[model samples]
Target: MMTMPTISNQNGAFPLLRKTELRRLLTEKQLQQLEQFCRASSKRAGSTLFRQGDPADTFHLLADGMVELRARPPGRRVYRTVELIGPSCTFGDEALFGETTYLTSSRVLETARVLALTRPAFDRLAANHPDIALGVLRCAGNCLIKTIRRSAILTQAPADVGLRMLLEELAGGNGNGAPIPVRITHAQLAGVLHVSRETVSRMLGQLASEGTVEVGRGIIRISSH
Candidate 1:
């Protein structure tokens, strides 16, 4: 039996819902009319929005907050960590582009405000907003570049190096600066490295022992020293 979507009301008069499946989450008609795009219906904190290999049936416009994109390894290990995408970003875009499913999993780091866009609605907007469409194309290109870089890193670099590269990206460079908060689990890290979870735990322990990084519950911090 098909399950009905649940709806909740909070922070606004309208209710949050997962219904309207296969419909455009946003409409060009609404945009052309200058009506507010869907209001912040709901917020998610430390939530997994989608999993790797899941069907890409919807797209999302992040109003605020961070989203991490992770990819599962080739083996049977269940974890993945490819990259982290920031606010004002569009994700779950494969549904609009091609037959491909969601290539990566997206997780929300904190309370996030997002607008959902179904495929048809996205298509209509793309038809009218050539500039916006091109912009999204560019973003997709950037996503591809990051994906390729991650693949190369894991294929050639050691686990520590892979972990370092992740830290560098998160820290936004400048080794002397404070390390960014990495909100992920060791199992996820292992998936990115295609290594065992135990290996990741051990490596992190070694780093902590050497004063290279600090570990916390649901957070990892790299040391500037």
Candidate 2:
């Protein structure tokens, strides 16, 4: 069964106008058309926004909260989470390019405010604002490609190196080479690394003993040394 969100009216210029890229991509009249057309919806936690193999009639931009995308093989019972979408992100985007069905299922992990646009609405916009729709598609596709590439680079590497590199990335380079502590768990690390929990634990413990990383409750701090 799928969970559905209730429609809500929005006032003022549509939220998409607030995005700089969209603002630059759209004309004044097109922007007004969007404001008049777009609306908002609130999805409760545990809501199944869409299911695998469902028709892809709409794509959504998340305003806040988390949505998890999970995939199960055509005849398999096992489902694995493929992505976690945060606020200000887009999902169901293949529909924008004419993909007929969803490859994965989308479930709300927390209460989420979403701005959903159907294929018909997008078509209406594209009639007069083709560039506007393409611009959003380009941004979304680039972001998705970059994320996939980064994840591949991280997870496909050897375990110890992968963990170190991922932590450094989270630390966001303070310029002086000091890295802030990042809160994460062994299970999460294992999942991303495609390694066993014991492997992650042993590797982390070894690094901690070498004075290279400080491991605390659900957090790992990289030593300045």
Using lDDT as the measure, the top candidate is 2
Q: Which ten residues in a row have the lowest lDDT in candidate 2?
A: 7-16
Model 2 earns a TM-score of: 0.68
lDDT of 2 at 84: 59
Clashes of each: 1, 0
Q: Which stretches of candidate 2 lie over 4 Å from their true place?
A: 4-13, 16-32, 160-193, 196-225
Model 1 weakest lDDT span, ten residues long? 13-22
TM-score of each: 0.67, 0.68
Model 1 bad stretches (over 4 Å): 1-42, 51-55, 61-64, 68-90, 100-105, 113-116, 173-179
What does candidate 1's lDDT look like per residue over 125-174, in tens digits? 57776554554456556655766777687758988877777665655444
Residue-level lDDT of model 2, residues 120-182, one tens digit each, is 888887786677777667656765785588679877898899877766654545445564575
Candidate 2 clash pair list: none
What's model 1's overall lDDT? 0.61
- Model 2, position 178: C-alpha lDDT score: 65
